[model samples]
Target: MPATTSLQSLHVMVWTALMASLIAVGSFLSIPLGPVPFSMQPLFIMLAGFLLGWPHGMIAVLLFVAAGSIGLPVFAGGKSGLAVLFGPTGGYLIGFVLAAGAIGLLTQARKTARTPSQTPSWALGLLAGLLGLALLYACGLLNLVRVLDIGWNKALTIGFLPFILQDLVKLVMAVATWRIMHGRGLLPR
Candidate 1:
């Protein structure tokens, strides 16, 4: 590869690792609420998508999950191993990849539409983040029903309902962070 391409690859690898670490750290800051805990994981996941775009963001999330599945204490409450991947909350864990991809794709689309002088819009960013969260919830709810042997109503109550408001807050925070980073030229265009 050319030197510039090689350097870019190195940059992406480093950011991917950093994002994975952020996800792991986010998992540690959790409030246990039955099977699916409330955590900062979604924030980092959204940030990864916003900053890294789809491919790299998805890679970062998958790496985080792989690390956790391999017995690294990188999951919520420091739980780990393959068992966790197959556990009740596993679907949500897996959903991180999809969520990041969705957010990244949306951001990328917006980015492509803008001129070099124009900045990303906060409303669009928030919409992308909310869509990502919705995808996560969909996966989580389906998995909750299957893993817990619960009905849709119970799954909605246990996994989705309580998280709506908090997730909206997270969505806003993610968008704000993205706006700040982009405004400061901390994020690549």
Candidate 2:
């Protein structure tokens, strides 16, 4: 039984690391659109939570950020180091951590609410994803306002305006992705 438990721990750890790496890959695959880039970071962030749950998913995001802080070049556009964290988009990075944790907690709750044989409710996942996106935008916009010394008007126009639609699409895609993966039993809740 100890061996089984240890093996399970290792399995989850592997998945956690994989999620972190995927986030890094997502950062690289980004399109620069002003202060914030259009990247798949949020998608993978939500997926990490959907699969890993609360602290583990949060840890994965932290690992990704730590890697970039240490000059691993994991941040968007091959950028790295502490400067990126203190830069215009730094708030979004923080958002990623919070959003991942929030999504994981919500999804975990949803899982606990149902039996193993029941199909998990997608509504909760959708709601969780939107909440995660909102956190990201809120953090990102706040940081953008502070870093650029811009008013809410300019910040909202440049930072939030462009992402409104794209972020929603990403949220939907994250839920859909999680549903398909969960259906396949790829990651047990």
Candidate 3:
């Protein structure tokens, strides 16, 4: 691969910052249902992957986490600081990074990731989005069990079950939005 020109590098940096800001903003729209909150963060997390791919997507998520860790009002319900990172739902925050990376990696594998204006392939995107949710729920459930010192069954009952329908809706929205943006040549590249 050719080295990135200074201008290209600047674009990447700007896009990363923009996407990170979006992820933080996504958290502001939240509903505290139980151990974890329901937020549009998932949509933007997956969108970070769909838009930036791999390292950029992952870094955008990391930037958001770092902001929240340092007293920024960027977490769910505008909560911030290490208390939130180590809190019961912290695993979900970590999962955001993993899911973004996972989704980006999967999207990149399609070869069209860098060329969003190409023909849309929702199949790969759908698969990646589903796996992203799986990973997020797994991390969330494990953390809930460990932090709360509860059983897996109980953790599932409270932590994972309630968000299924809502998350699925978000996933679908992410895919549809990706398609619309891709068709419009609006995805970051």
Winner by TM-score: 2
Cα lDDT tens digits for candidate 2, 1-189: 999888889998999999999999999989999878888888899888888998899999999999999999999999999999999999999999999999999988778777665655678888898888889889999999999999999999988888778778877888888777777777733
TM-score (C-alpha) between model 1 and the true structure: 0.94
TM-score of every candidate: 0.94, 0.96, 0.92
Candidate 3 RMSD to the correct structure: 2.3
Clashing pairs in 3: none
Which tens-of-lDDT digit does each residue in 1-189 have in candidate 3?
345676677887898999999999989999988778888899999988888888899999999999999999999999999988888988898899999999989887786444645856788788999999888888888888889999989988888788888888999888888878878877677
Candidate 3 TM-score over all chains jointly: 0.92
lDDT of 1 at 113: 86
Clash number for every model?
0, 0, 0
Write the candidate numbers in order of decreasing lDDT: 2, 1, 3
Which model is ahead, 1 or 2, in terms of lDDT?
Answer: 2
Give me the runs in candidate 2 sitting further than 4 Å from their true place.
none
Residue 49 in model 1: lDDT = 94
